[model samples]
Target: MIPFRFLHAADLHLDSRFAGLAHLPAAVRSYLRESTFAALGRLICLAIKENVDFVVISGDIYDVSDASLQGQLRFQEALKELGEQGIPVFLIHGNHDPLDGPRLVAEMPEHVTVFGGDAPGYATAHRRRDGQEVAIVSGISYPTAKVTANTAVTFSRKPGSELFHIALLHGNVDGDLQHETYSPCSRKDLIGQGFDYWALGHIHKRSILYEKPYIVYPGNIQGRSVKETGPKGCYVVDVRENGEAALQFHELDIVRWQVTELSIDGMEHEAQWVEAVERRIEDIREADPHLMTVVRFRLTGRGNVHRLLAEKGAAADLLSELQRREALRAERKEYPGLVWTEGFAVESGLAVDRSRLLQEDSFLGEMLRLAEKGEGEGSREELEDIISSAIAPLMENRELRRLLSQVSEEEKLDWLRGAAELGITLLSGLEGAGEAEGGFRDKPDGGRYDED
Candidate 1:
């Protein structure tokens, strides 16, 4: 039996536009761009430190269809470092990095073996220490961006070989929703192929669908958005003598994306709100001190701060001031190693006084009544259209739009409360009676009337 270790990594997304990252401070932006290569360098260092036999990069090394020469050279230099240390590297092209275009890996070091986008291809190598031959790999690359049929059907375990077999594939498994069915295959298909390990890629979230043949995704080395939060990186697998494997995740991501929600309901002033936000930030920093975070905050609840948040430009200004103060604090060694707060999303505003609105028989009240009636008697589509139109102005407003986009659970509950109040007030007004002065009053005919 041949015992060996290997590093598996995928979805580098190198040189991709840091779209939302522009809001970050200049130093953070610089770190983000450079962090992709730095993570790859770290992966190489890990491989060298662990004395792995070879490194397998499943796919998507670069983000652009036409990759930059500088990016290619940077990757080449890192791979060269591994080659100089007598370690071999193998790779396959994924959907993002197809093979029909200019080959980026063409001038790579001799130790690098890239499987081209052609018919079934495989590689055989021997372990130098034990002189034991091993069927190291088999794979197919994406010829073009779209591949509808299964690419794995073409590959089979090497015949008449006593060595342990492994297959490297860059395709979506049957259940993945985010990826196209490019090079699609199934767990059953891979397990029946007699391969010992299947290194898979194209999905940015790491997963292990099957363990019998060891099918796995190493996920992306770095997260690009809030959706891809938490620790992001590759995996290190140790293949034992009896064909068993042990997998360990290694986080190589330098920049982290975090979403945090802070409630300002009980807090009386903006200073308290800032302190609350700072406390939350400090908590996250202590939990993951090395992380460079892109945090999104949702400040909510009914309080004096809520009125301030309702005013135009006030919420944004307050958030900016808070971030500036925190940044300054970080600079003064009060909170050392703290990265910039990328951006602030206010998911808070003044809780609507629906009862007050209904009492006045205003246009908003009429709209709410119409919405409720439509919801009860109208078709689903009609009801949806009515509600959407009723909320159109709020959605169109830039500040409200931003707030609603990242609304927290408490904000949602507040909205529900407002809705309930509106419903009750509308019901009361329908009981017709003469107007009175402030609050709701009962008329002689057993009806309730709202006072103006």
Candidate 2:
């Protein structure tokens, strides 16, 4: 029986510049681009400190098509240090670094073995102190960028052997959505091969598909964008003599990206809105001081501020003020850094008068009645067409159309409710003849252009 530990990592995307990082503060942009290599250094240090048996990099060690010679040399230098300590490194080339052209494997340390894209291969390493031998790893690289068939079937575990077996693959599992369908293989397909563990890559989010045989994705070593938020890192797996494996996640990302939403529905004053936004930023920074957040705020519900936000130059002025406050806070060291707020996507507007419309004996009223009939035993499509035709003229009206466009989906629904309420009030107040022409009366609450 033998005990060993290994670090499973994927999607390093090293030496990659995030073009979007330019939107962030200069300090933050520097951190994101430089931190990736720094995190890789930490990973190597951790492996040395933990005295792990080996390191398995599933794929995408570098982002460049042909990685810089300096970058290649630096990587080889790190591998050389591990080789000096008698630790072996197993690696596979992912889509980002396909095997067919401009190879760097030749420059790496002798202890590092890279699997070629042509065929599946494995390397054997021995536990010196105990004299127990284990199959260190097996994998195949991407011959070209796209692999549509099963790469797992080409790999088979050693025959009639009880030694620990692990397969490193840089491809998609049966149902991963974030990545293209590359080197597609099923969980059953891998299990049938009798491997003890499957190291997967291509998906940036970390996940554990099965624990019994330990199929896992260590996620991306760093968060590249808003989409890749939260803690990004690798997994350290400890395989015991009894075949029971224990896994622990280690934070390998130096910089992170996060999304937070702020609601400005009830905020009536600019000061109050600023205060609320400041509070939210503080909360986010406190949660993760190293986080570079991209906020997408939604201002919903009915409020006077909605009208102000709707005015020309008002929204732009608010964004500028918010940016100034964020900068000040960051300068004072109150918050880590506000990358940039995508914007306060507002969804607020004036209430509509619906009661008056319902009381009218016009075509609009008849359409509203049909709409209110609800999803009954009728053709929903036909009823929707009628309702659409009825509302088309109003929707096409320039002022109403502009207001509707300014508000959010939910706020538009609220405006519809207001129209219904007003229609009801006018209907109750009108006599027979007056009610007939009520639908076209130029909006009693000071016309459609009124401040309300």
lDDT string for model 1 (1-452, tens) is 66777788888877666654445446545666776787787788888888877788888887765777877788888888988878788888777777775645576677788888877577875564564565557777787877778877777877777676767788888646556667878888888888888888887788998898788988889877655667888888887888788999999887777666676666667778767777777787787777666566655444556555544345566557656765564445443346445444444444445456555675666756554455454345654555456568899889777655555444444454445444543453432211111121132122321110
| lDDT score at residue 408, model 1, on the 0-100 scale | 46
Q: How close is candidate 1 to the true structure, as a TM-score?
A: 0.73
Query: What lDDT would each prediction earn against the true structure?
Result: 0.68, 0.68
lDDT of 2 by residue, 175-263 (tens): 56556778988888888888889998888889998887888999988877656767889999888888878999998776675555455
Clashing pairs in 1: none
Give the C-alpha lDDT of model 2: 0.68
Where does model 1 exceed 4 Å of error?
A: 20-24, 103-105, 299-304, 312-314, 322-336, 348-452
What is the alpha-carbon lDDT of model 1 when measured against the actual structure?
A: 0.68
TM-score of each model, in listed order: 0.73, 0.72
